[model samples]
Target: MALGLALPAAAQNVDGVVRPAWAPSGLPDRVVLSPGADAARQMAVAWRTDARQADAVAEIVEAIDGPAFESRARTVDGLSTDGVVRGGHGRYHTVRFTDLKPGAGYLYRVKGADGWSEWLSFRTAADEAAPFRILYFGDTQNSILSKGARTIRAGLMRTSPDVVVHAGDLTGRSHDWEWGEWTAAGGYGYAMVPQIPAAGNHEYSDDDDGRRRLGPLWAAQFALPENGAEGVVETSYYTDYQGVRFIVLDGTAGTSLDALDAQTRWLDRTLASSTARWNIVIQHQPIYTCARPNDTEALKAAWEPIYRARNVDMVLQGHDHCYSRITDGDGKASGEARRAQGAAQGPVYVVSVAGPKMYGLNDRALTQPDRVAADTQMYQTIDVEAGRLRYRAYTVSGVLYDAVDVVRAADGTKTLREPVESLPPLRLCDGDVGPDGAPCVGSAK
Candidate 1:
């Protein structure tokens, strides 16, 4: 059976099986950078190679303009974990670089059985409260290399964010071929920009004993901070970058497993102890969903109170393969009306999609969402500063769809104001017709 989709640049289809082009041979592939607990002073990198490279070896140096910086490079040894997957057997290596100068630029490369990878460059976050940018995506779960790659490339070239946040569902069924397509889609962008990802339901599947388990490749592909709620530490963690504290939650586990209470308690404690000027929550399920018939009641009940009381500036989510920016939870009034009525602004809840799969909006889409879209692929760029956070959403082709700024006053109050430029009309299905006048792929829930 031929998979009716475009083959990834490095993949091949043979005998009804999709084979990974990056089946972890010599030469490091799928190189990804992740933020440490302390973004300024620490950084982590993870890569894969075949068993021939039993040891994890890498080299780092303070990068200089001249070509002789390699002379000052220092070798670093890391640990490796062996894993078996559909495509092949390989070892995943992870290394954390510490005791580095804050706000410093550095270069690093990994070793494989055959040779060394090309040097990759990255800069540590500044130690002080400063301005930075974050590029966000939702659910690159389907058609990753063909459709999703364009959005990633567009965001990278247009904004060049210091960090990237993924709101889960990175693959359709967590298959090795899907993961390979994902890594190929991002290419070297994954190697340079640090990623903070939340685990979606697709990342979890039931084991033989009926226990829900995270995907086998998740831990191997991305190195993330371990500071999180006790049981779900791998999926729930926090990383502070610049003036923002990004708290990631495992919504899948919280909703399905017996981890909701623990996560709620941890979220409250973490938020209470936060020292950053702005707080943002990254989770896979949305508090105010746009596609499903009803909201994710389980997670919303468990975590929404903490978000409200703790003053979480934004709640970024995926799972709903549509787009929505909801500021008023009650669905009582428009965001502009509430602002005009002097309403105390709460967290801005946003759900966006970057993949080909899409769902039609539900009944609440009529009035609840300040902005909503269907049958669309979207990406967002957020510029965070001490006084304001500027958010802009764009299409895969780089058309601006939505823009807003959350202005923080001296007394810590926030106001959501739109940019002076007008936005395009909402992208929604016109009865049986899609926004583009094609056969509607966005099916109703």
Candidate 2:
């Protein structure tokens, strides 16, 4: 069968698209793995199929030394919702894996009309504070099938990540074809490791009633943890994995729900209740912008104090199509993360993009960002250890862009350690053209 079937020209993307395959659903496409409320003992998988499948079941078994593993498998019938995604009618199936054994390998597959899907494997998080790694992406919102796929695939090849974090804008639109293209770009990698995605502006669209709605494909595409702040449960949620407490937030504007107040209280409580050694926040829009001249002023006014009072370690964000790392509002580059004695640590805010769309750096990026880049595709690898956390940013070509380490002491204080190393010369666009001499793929809006 073809990897992805093309849509008739009439159904071609309204805006330009790089990856443009649609799922017809004899077999499942867009298979993705996401962490459940508790990562150490539970996970979830979501996939799409044609309406012909009235029901679907997921079978999981512990992976063992031999092919007889199927004999001990357990089956769970997942919930399915049939809907129209931009003119395509299909069913989205999701199953929550309960009672999973921590730090153990498990194999699973989904059922379709013809047969079961090829076996896929995943490992649960360790039971306690232990070493692990997470891959963070800014936005794969455009040219996902072309330029974005390269960086996503490159990161997977470089490190075996235990969890993936997406700072929203997974697609330019909520159309199913674009969603399929996104899943195809990640391929099995999305199915193998758990992904935590925050909602982005592009993921929302006006409904037939003229009411704005969270991308129809969202809550359906990735089976995200539902344990979130009240009112925004579908888009704002949290997941505890290894020694990290990862909070997913919904900051998208003009959606049906008003998230400002409800999410603010939730943020305070969520951070106050954190028991994990590492606390990380993932939001699509930045409280501080690197590409846009205006900051997310509302977000900063409401949540910045909460983040600081809680000592949140990192803020992973997207929605600017540029890259930035700032430690505070002083406009001074965060020269080193490892601070000297008596210096308190603050959340190190990072904004980046992985998709083909690139935007020029703004004034804050020029003066405040410890690191900044333009017209480049990048990926970040975060290594989580019991006493320390290490971070590295690499361009799609695999050259290091930035590196930092946060060392945690027994008293819960963190010191910074920024590596001193030279990377490939920074690439900045020459007006509408890129440093490589090709027309810049980013819109520079």
Candidate 3:
């Protein structure tokens, strides 16, 4: 999904591990906002300051039309954790604002040694199921700023999404410079829209002893909802926004950081008890893949049945660095025509890559997926309503690439209805030349 550009000093070297410079620190940097499980009642924000600013402080006030808004302001102190990132010491701060009014706009700011950060504004979700939009991005791993930033900006410019969901691998290497470019790429987008980030394999570190732990930056950078399986609380969690239930799972099934069984059990219970009209699962690795030679057989064997039995609407995934959309019985025969015959549908599995790291589509790319793309960077936008949901996919430059509409039935069932839309021609490599008239990049293996 990427074609690399000469990176700036702010980016990492070819190794993706070592980098130059300590994190810039005059004001708060890498500010991010995450929605609590009960988005209508609580919100969470995390920001990075220098190690000197050990104590964390933040304040929130109802956004007023004029400048006289200090009377009703509420200030809160939060827990701060200090750690070494890329060899330099820094402090990260997080604060959760609870007992908030649903469907209200609020302005908040964090404090540092120099002064308080710029006042940022955000709106909470409504108390009940309502119309809302969300933006989804696959791995923004390679060439984050040089290539992936444009894709993120394209999403910001095109729609008004209530939430932003990352299918994982925000960076190829969990280093400071890569994260810097990622933040600069998204810029204020991360602060404005509530983030629902899933943990990717690249985000974990396998120690010499073969124990897998989250990268130093993951847990410290974002405060996610805690409503997950008790054993895998850090990476496995779920959030309910408006009327949609977003179940996030860690897909490192057999790794040292394995949580496949706990997550499987939690997913079943979560879906069974869900009252939301729509249910969507987000994870790092794909249940079905177009880039890798085969699917994550472990994930498919464990989670696929639960997704089907629960009647989940969509399974958003990343880590393959390729694009694919596979529906049930899609590859067998009469894929699209299966709709012609009366048969119940299951969750739509999607795998996409947004960063510059590109991989060749597997042989099944042509037949298994409803649609597939290789060496292409793209983004997807989903709009949710009371009984209808619409999903649209677009290229980095903002061209509509794919889409479908879903209608909820009277019995809490849903149906994906493909809408007719024109898209650009498929991109492929001709000998050694690419569709861009440049050397064909990425892998075809």
C-alpha-based local distance difference test score of model 3: 0.80
TM match of model 2 to true structure: 0.92
Listing every candidate in turn, what is its Cα RMSD in Å to the true structure after a full C-alpha superposition? 3.8, 3.7, 3.5
Tell me the number of clashing residue pairs for each predicted model: 0, 6, 1
Sort by TM-score, best first. Answer: 1, 3, 2
Error of 2 at 204 (Å): 0.4
Looking at model 2, the pairs that clash are 337-416, 338-415, 338-416, 338-417, 339-416, 358-442
Better of 2 and 3 by lDDT: 2
lDDT of residue 230 for candidate 3: 62
lDDT of every predicted structure (CA atoms):
0.86, 0.81, 0.80
- Residue 34 in model 2: lDDT: 95
lDDT of 2 by residue, 1-445 (tens): 0122222222345553423356455687778999987898999999877788768689999999788888899999989888464344578889999998999999999877666788888999988989988999989988777668877888777777888899999989887667766887788888888998998988888789876777778878888888888877888889999889999888874124567888889888988999989999999889888888788888889888999899899999999998787876666444332344356768889998998888887766777877788888889989998887898898888889888887889999877776787766666776788878998665545
Candidates 1 and 2 compared by TM-score, better number: 1
lDDT of 3 by residue, 1-445 (tens): 1212222355455554444443546478777899999888889998888877878799899898898887788998887887475332478889988998999999998888778887888899889999999899999987788788878887876776789999999977667676778777777678768999998988877779887767778877788888887677877888888899999988863334466777888989999999987899999888888877777888889898999888899999998878877876358355566655756567888888888888777778788877777777899989997778788888887778778887778887666688888867766656677667887676865
Off by over 4 Å in 3: 1-22, 85-88, 253-256, 329-334
